[model samples]
Target chain A: MSGKEALLEVDGLKKHFKVNQGWIASLMESFGSGEPDYVHAVDGVSFELREGETLGLAGESGCGKTTTGMSLVKLHEPTAGDIIYDDQRLSEATDAEIKKFRQNAQMIFQDPFESLNPRMTVYDTVAEPLRIHDIPNETARVQRALEFAELLPAEHYFDQYPHELSGGQRQRVAIARALVLDPDFIVADEPVSMLDVSLRAGVLSLLDRMTDEFGLSVVYISHDLSLLRHMCDRLAIMYMGKIVEKGPTDQIIENPQHPYTQALINAVPVPDPGVGRDRVELQGEVGDVIDIPTGCRFKNRCSEYIGDVCDQVVPPLEQKTEFEQDVACHLYESAAGYDPYEEMSGSPSAAETGDGAESTPADD
Target chain B: MSQLEVEDLEVYYETEEGPAQAVDGVSFELEEGENLGIVGESGCGKTTLAKAIIGILPDAGYINNGSINFKGDDLTEMSGPERRRLKWEEISMIAQSAMNSLDPVYTIREQIVEAIETHRPGTGRVESDEIVTEMFELVGLDPERADDYPHQFSGGMRQRAMIAMALALEPSLMLADEPTTALDVIMQDQILKRMGSIQEEINSSMLVITHDVSVVAETCDRVIVMYAGKIAEEGPVEEIFNRPYHPYTIGLKRAFPNIRKSSQDLLSIAGYPPELVDPPQGCRFAARCPMATDKCREEEPEAHYENGLRSYCHYADEIDTELRPYADDSDTWSQTAAATDGGVEE
Candidate 1:
C-alpha cells in the first residue's frame, strides 16, 4: 500500500500528564524556576497505519503503548503533535469533526467485564454506539453489529446481561459494540490479555475475521510480542514513549537490531522441548518515566550501548537498510560519516530487504 | 518410595446451588527435591488441589475422600492441632496473587518474623531478624528493604518476599500457585530462576500450578496436564512436550507460540473446557477430543504407564504415529460454529 492508502498517521505524538504535587509544591516549583514534573507517557512517537493493515504497538507495561492508542482515538488529548486520519489532521479538527472521527475510529478495550456496563443488556450495549452515531435504523444496526460480531441469532444474547455471558462471549459483545458504527479503524488495547489461553484464540480469530470483513485498519497494542507477530502485518517496538524500531512483522522478529527488541524476543519461551534458547534477562526494572534521561531512552539497560554517544545526543530515527526498518540508535551510525544504510547493507540477513520480501503470506 | 502421595483426593466447596467438586479424585506424587508442575485452564481444580495439600482450604470447602501421604504420615488423618503444627513445619504455600498475600500494614521483616515466631516458638527476635535478612539476600532482594512495607515493593519483590516467608519455616514442600502470572517477562524469569535455585539450596520438593505450559517447560522436572479436574497426562516435561501421549496435551503444545518458531500459525483448541459440575461420565475430554470414539463415551480411560510416563487415553499405544497427525490437522478438532449453551446448570 502507498502513502495515499494510509488510514492513520501519528506524527511526533506526545501525551504528558502534569504530576500534581500539592498546590504548595507546584507554586514553589513555579517560583523556584525548577522543572515541573510530568509523566511523559507518549513522548514524540510517530508511525503510520496503512488501510486494512494491523499495526501492532508492543512494549512492556507503563511503556506508553496504551497511552499512544488512547491518544490516537482522542480518549486522552495529545500534549503535542498531530494525528492525521484519511488526509485530515485530527489535531486541527473541530468538535463536530472529532465526533465524526470517533464514529469512524472506534476502540475495543482490554477488560470486557469492566468495559461493559453491567446494567445494560448485550443488545443495549451493542446498540449504544449506533444510538450515539444516530443511525437511521437502530434495531437493524444493532442486529447487523451482533451478527458481524458472531453473536449469532442476535435474540439469544440481546436480552442477556454482561454478567450472564462468559469471558469470550462478553468480549464478542465488546467487539460488537465497537463495530456498531461500522468503523474503518479500531484500536484494540490488550484485548485478549485478560482471557484464558483457551479463550484468547477465539477472540483473536474473531478480531482477525472482523478486520478482513470490515476492511479495518487496526492499532493492536499489547505486551505479547508472539501474539502480535501472529496477527499484525507491521509492528513498532516502543520504549519509554518512543518508537525505537518499526518495520514489517516478520522482519522485526526474524532479526531485531535494537537491544531492547532483542531482549524482548529472547524472553519469549519456545514451545519446542528440544530447543533451549538463552533467556536474556534485563538488568534492572524499567526506569522512571517522570524524568527521563537524555539521549537514548533505553541506554541504561542496552547491552550494546557505547558510552557517551548514548548519553550525549538524542539519536534521530533514521531509516536503515533498503527495507522499511527505521531505528533510533547511535550504534547504527557509520564511523566514516553518517551513512545509516551502510550497517544495513553490511549484514546479509533476510531482514535487510529494501523492497517487500514476501517470504510468507499473512496467516490470519 | 514416593516422598509425597495423594490418593483419590476429593475437595469440594458448598456453594448455593449445592456442593461443587473442585478437586475430584486427583492423584499425583512428588519425589524429594523434585519440581512438579500441575498444568490446567482456569477453574480446573489445580489451585484447589494445591490448597488442600497446604491445609489452607477455606472453611466452606471440605475433603470428602482422600489420603495425603507425606513421607509416611497420612496428612488427612491428622487432627486440627496436628495439621496446624504440620503446616510451615513440613509444608507451605505461596498464593497466586502476591499483592493480596502480603499483609499491607506490616513491614516485610515483621511478616517473616511473625511466621518464624509462630512456627518456632522459642526463636528470639534478633535470631529471626538474622534469618529474615539471610532469606532476603537469598531471594536477591536488598537486605535493607526488610523494613519496607508491602506497598513499597514492586510486584516481583512482593512475590520474593512471599517466597522468603514460605522459606522462613524451612518447610519440606512448597506449593506455589501461578506465582509469576501477573509479572512481566523479565520479572517472571528472575522470580522463576530464583525459585528454582532456592529449591535446590533448601532441597525441598515443589508443586507449581500454572496455566502457562511454557513456564512448566522451563521450570518443571515433571508435568501433569489436568482437564476438568482430572489428569489427562503425566510425564517428564521433555516427554510431555516432545511425545505427548494424550490428545489434550498435544493440543496444548500446538496452541502455545514459541520464539524459535515465530512463523508457524498458533493453533487453538476449538472447544471450551468441559464444566466440572456434572461432567461427562466416561472421558471428560471426549467432547473436544479429535480421536474420541464411542468407547471413550462409554468408559473412562485408565492410567497406562509406558516408558516411565502415564497417560489416560483410549489409544495411548497409538500415540507414536496417530497423535501427531490428528493434532497437526487443526480442521479435525474444529467444532461446529454453533454457539453452545451458557451458564452453569444447577
Candidate 2:
C-alpha cells in the first residue's frame, strides 16, 4: 500500500472567496480598512491521495475542510495552486481532459436531500453521469452502479422519485450516481453525517467496501473524528484553512500533539458514561476565518502559546517523530536556536507546553 | 410532589388520513432538581412529549388523554389562559435550533427582557436589561453582545441566549429538546457544562430529549428509550447503558460505533421503526426484534420492573443470559427490506 502510485496530488491549494459585502457595508469597510476583505477558505493546503487509500479531512465548521474538498473536484475552482491528477494538471486541462477529469473524479455531498434532484427518477439520476460522459449502454451502467451502491435489486428504485425514498435510500441513489461513471477517485464530504446511528454503519461499510472493490482513491471529509478512525487510513486536521497536523489515524487520535486537536478529541463524548475526560475548553469562538491572524491561526486560543515568537513567525509543518506526520506548532521546535529539524529527534519542549497548559481567558 | 409527572399521556395529531398517535401511553416522573433524558429516533414522539409538557403543540396536535402533573397543578386540566400564564413563569422550554427560536428582529437583550416583562409584569426595561445582562454573564457570553440579534451571534451563542431567555424567569421545570444536536462536540460539551451549572444554581428539574445516547449518558440521571411512540425501556443511565434490558435499547447501544472500542463491524438494526400511523398491535418492535416470538406478536407485555429498570418486554428477566445474546447478534434483527422486498423501501 505504501509503494502504490499516488492517484491525486493536491499541492499548495488555496481557495479564497471575496466577502460579499454589498454596497453600503463595503463602503463602510472601504473607509476603515481601505481594502475589500476575502474569506481565506482554503489557504495553502497540500496533501496527496494514494491510490486506494482513504484520507480524512477533519475540522470544525468554517475550518475549510469542505472548501478544500470542493476545490479539488472543481466544484469551486481552486483560487490558487495546482492539482495534479493521474499525469494531468487539472486546471490546465483542455475541454476533453476536463471532461475526463470530471468523469474520473466524483463527489458525494453532506445532504442527500438537497443534492439529489426532486423530480429525477433514481434511474435518470444515476444515468445522468453516464449520458454526460457519453458512455455506451447507459441503462445497464445505471443498474450496475445502483447495485454497487448496495441498492439491492436496483429495479425497485429505478422509477421512484427522490421524495418517495427514505433518507438512507436517497443517499444510496446519490452514491450510485457518483459511481455511475466508474470514477477513479471520490470526494465524500461528511457522507454519513446526516444519517441515523443505525443506518450510518451501512453507508460507511458500503463506502469502505466500494473503495476497496473499485481501488478508488478517496478523500473522506468529516468532523466526526470517531467515524474517521474507522473510515480513513490517514487523517489530516485542518484549522483556519490550513493543515495543522497529518498522520496515521490511530497515531493522531492516541497522541495528538497540537492543542486544538487534543481539545477536539477530548471534547467528543465516548459512548459509555464510565469514561470521563480531562476537558480543555477552547476560549471564545473560533476566530473569524475572514480576519485570520498573522501567526498561527490557533495561537490566540492555544494552550501552548509561546510569547512573541509565536506571534511573530508562522510555524512550518515539520515531521517530528518516526510515526508522527507533520506538526505545525512551535512547541516541537528548539527554542534557543529554533531549529525544527534538530529538535525533531528530541522530546517536545515540555516546560513551554505547560506554561499556558490551561486555556487563557478570552480577552474580548 | 415530584417536579414533573406525566401519567399515561396520550397525544395525537390529526393527519390528512386519520389520527397519528404521536405519544401513546407514556409515563415518567422527575424528582426535584433531577435530570431525565428521552432518547429516540426522529418521529418517535419525544418532541411531541416535550411540546405537550410545555403546552405548545401544533394546532393539529391534541392531548387526548392522561394527566401532566407539574408541581401541584394538573397541566393537562388547565385552561388555555391558565397554561399561558404558567409558561416561562413556572414551566419554560428551550426549543431546538435557536436560530429560528430566537426572534431575528430583536436583540438578545430585547427578547429575553420581553420574556422577563411578560412573567414579572410592570418590570421596567432597564431592570429587564440588567437581568438579561446577568444571564449573559452566567452563560459566559460577553455582556456587550446582548444587543446583537440572533443572526449576529454564533450558533452556540444563539443557543446560549435561548437558554438564558428560557431560564430568565427562573422556571422550576425546563424542557430542552436536542439543545446541542446542531453544535460541534466541543461547543456541545461547553454548553452542556454551562447548562448543568445553571440548572444546579436554580435547582430546577431538566427533561432533555435527544437522539444522541452519549448526551443522555453524560447529562441525565434517568433514561427513557422510546420506540414507535412508546417507552421501550426506562432506567438509571448506568443501568440502561451497561445492562440494557429491552431489545430496542440493546440494538441502539450496539448500533452506534463506539470510539472507545476497537474498530469492528458496527451493529446495525435491519428495519426502520414501525410507522406510527396506525402502528402495529402487541409489541410495536416485534417486527424488528430478533427475540420476538409468536407470543410477542399476539400480546403486548406490561412493564416488567427489576433492579429499578423497567422494560416493556416479555423476556426482560432473561436479559443477561438469553435475550442479550440474541440482541447482540445482528443476524437476529430484521435486515433491511432490500433482501426481502428486492430493493430499498421507504
Candidate 3:
C-alpha cells in the first residue's frame, strides 16, 4: 500500500476535552487567567488506511483506540493536526465537502444493542443511512445492503424490530446500516467484542468478506491481538494515544518490536494444552493517562528498560525492519542503531521469529 | 467414589411459551482434587449447571428431573435447613461477575464475616478475621484492603475478594462460573493462576464453567465440551487439544485464538446453536457439525472411548484425520467449510 492507495490518513491527531471546574474554581481561574485541565483522550497519533485493507488498532482499555476511531470520523473535533481523506484535508473542508465525505466514511459501533434504535424496525434501521446520504431507490438499496450482510430474503427481517432479532442478526443489521451507503472506509470499533463466542466468528467473517467485496478500508479497533492477526493485513499497537508499533500483521505478531506489544502478545492465552510459553507479567496496572510518564509510556512496566535514557526523554518510532515495521522502544534503539531494517533483508518466516523481535532499543 | 456426582440433571425455566430445558439430562462427576472444566457457548447451560449444583438457581428456575450428590449426600432431596447447613461448608461457588455479586453497601470483611457466621456458627469474630486475612493473602490481596467496599476495588481485586469469601470455609469442591470472563488478560492470568494454586493447596476439586477453550486448556486437568444441554466430548486436556474426537470439539478448539500461533485465524462454527426448548433429535450439534450424517441426525451417538478419551460422535473414529490441521488455517471460513461439507459428509 502506497499513499495513492490510502483511503484515510490521520496525521498527528489530538483530542483533549476540558474538565469542568467547580463554580468557585471557575471564577478563580477566570480571574487568574489560568489554563483549565484537559483530559488527554487522544494525543499525537498518526496512521494510514489502504483501500480495502483492514488496519487493526489494538491496545488495553482506556488507551484511546475508541477515541482515535471517533476522532477519525469527526465525531469528536481534532484538537490539533489534520485528517486527510482521499487527498482532501477534512479539517479545512467546507460543510458540503464534509457531508460528501460522510457518504464515503462510516462507523460500526461496539454495542449493537445500544447503537440500534429500539423504536425502528430492521428495514428502517438499514435505510436510515441511505436516506441521510439521499440515496435513490431506497427500498432496493436497503434490501441489497441486507443481502450483502447475509440477512437473506429481506422481507422476513425488514419489519422485525432490533429486540426481535438474535444478537448475531442484530449485528448483521448494524453492519448493513454501515454498508448501505457502499462507503469506502469504515471504523469498526470493537464490533464483535460484545457478542458471544459463536456469534463473534460469524460477524468477523462477514466483515472480512464485506471488506473484499465492497472495496472498503477498515480501521478495526480492539484489545484482542489474536483476533486482529486473523482479520487485519496490518496493525498499529497504541499506548497512551501514541502508535507504539506498526507493521504488517505477520511481522508484528511474529516479530513484535515494542515492549508493550511483547507484553500484550505474552498476556494472550494460548489454546493449545501441550504448548506452554513463559508469560512476562507486567508490574502494577496501566498508569494514569492524565500525568503520563515523560519518556516511553511503557518504561515503568517494561522488562528490558535499561536506565536514565528511558526516563529522561521520549522515544520516536524508528524503522526496525526493512518491511515498513516501526517501534518506539529504547532497547531496540541501542542494539540496532536507529533503523534496524537496513541490516536485515526480506521478511523472516513466522516460525524463525521469537520474543526477541521486541527487544530492540528506542529512538530519541 | 467421586466427590461430586450430577446425574440426569434437568433444570427448566417457566416461560410463557413453555418449559425451557436448560440442562436436560446432563451427567458428570468430579473426583477429589481434580479440576473439571465445563466448556460451551452462551445459553449452553454451563452457568445453569453451576447454579444448580450450588442450589442457587433463580426463583423462576426449578429442577424438573435428576439428582445432585455431593459427598454421597443427595443435595436435591435435602431439606431447606439441611441444604443451608451443607451450602458453603462442603461445596461453595465463585459467582460470575464479581462486580455485581459483591454487595455494594458492605465492606469485604463484613460480607465474608456474614457468610462465615451463617455457615459455621459459634466461630468468634477473631477466628473469622484470622481466616479472612489468610484467604486474602492466599489470593494475593493485601489483608489491609479487607476494610474497603466492593466499589473501591478494581474488577480483578473484587474477584479475588469473592474467591477469598468462597474459600473462607475451605470447602471440598468449588464451582466457579465464568469467573474470569469480564476480566482483562493480565487480571485473568493472575486470577486463574491463583485459583489453580488454591485448589492444590486446599486439596479440593473444582468445576470451572467457561466459554473460552483457552482458559480451560490453561487451568483445567480434564475438559468437557458441551452443546445444547448435552456433553459432546470429555477427555484429558492434552488428548482433547492434540486429538479431538467430536466435530463440535474440533470446531471449538479451532475457534479459540491462541497466542502461541499468531498466524492462524479463529474458526467460527458456521451455524447457530439449536434451540434448547425443543432441541433437535439425535446430536444437538448435528445441525452445525461438519461431519453430520443420516445416522447422526436419526440417532444420537453413544459415548465411545478410545485411547483414554471419550467422545459422543457416530464417526469419531473416521473424523480424527479430518479434524487435524484445522487450527492452522489463516482464513477458516473457506478451509473449514470445504473440509467437512465435502468428502466425509458424502
Give DockQ for candidates 1 onward, in order.
0.46, 0.58, 0.38
Per-residue alpha-carbon lDDT of candidate 1 for residues B246-277, written as tens digits (9 for 90 to 100):
88887777676665654665556656776565
lDDT of 3 by residue, A1-364 (tens): 3243877888878777667779998998989877667666677788888888999999887788999999887888888778998789998899999998888888999888999999999999999887787789999989988888777667778899988877777888999998888888889998988887865876898898877777778899998877888888999998876789998898888877788887777777778877776677677667776665656678888888877556644676767534368887766644356532322233333112211222122111
- Give the 10-residue window scoring lowest on summed lDDT in candidate 3 chain A: A355-364
- The TM-score of candidate 1 is 0.91
Give the per-residue lDDT digits (tens) of candidate 2, residues B134-174.
89888889989999888988899999988898889988889
Arranged by TM-score, best first: 2, 1, 3
Distance from true position, residue B215, model 3, in Å?
A: 0.7
Q: DockQ of candidate 1?
A: 0.46
lDDT of 1 by residue, A1-364 (tens): 3233888889888888877688888888879867667887878888888888899999888889999999888898887778998789997888899999999888999999999999999888888877777778888888888887767678777899888887878898999888888888899999988887866766788788876777888899998877898888899998887888888888888888788888888877655556776677677778888877755788888888787556645565667544457877777753335643443445434223211121111111
Relative to the unseen true structure, what is the C-alpha lDDT of residue A295 in candidate 3, on a scale of 0 to 100? 60
- Candidate 3 iRMS, in Å? 5.1
Off by over 4 Å in 2: A1-4, A24-33, A334-364, B122-126, B331-346
Query: Which candidate number has the best DockQ?
Result: 2
Q: Residue by residue across B1-346, what tens digits does model 3's lDDT show?
A: 8999889899998887788888888788889999999998888888888888888899989999999999899899988889877778778889888988899999999999998999878999999999999999999899999999999998888998999999989999899988888877777877888888888899989999998888888888999888888888888999988887877777777776665565565667756677767778888887766556688898988988886788988888776656445433435444544453222110
Docking class of predicted structure 3: acceptable
Residue-level lDDT for A218 in candidate 2: 86
Give TM-score, chain B, model 3. 0.92
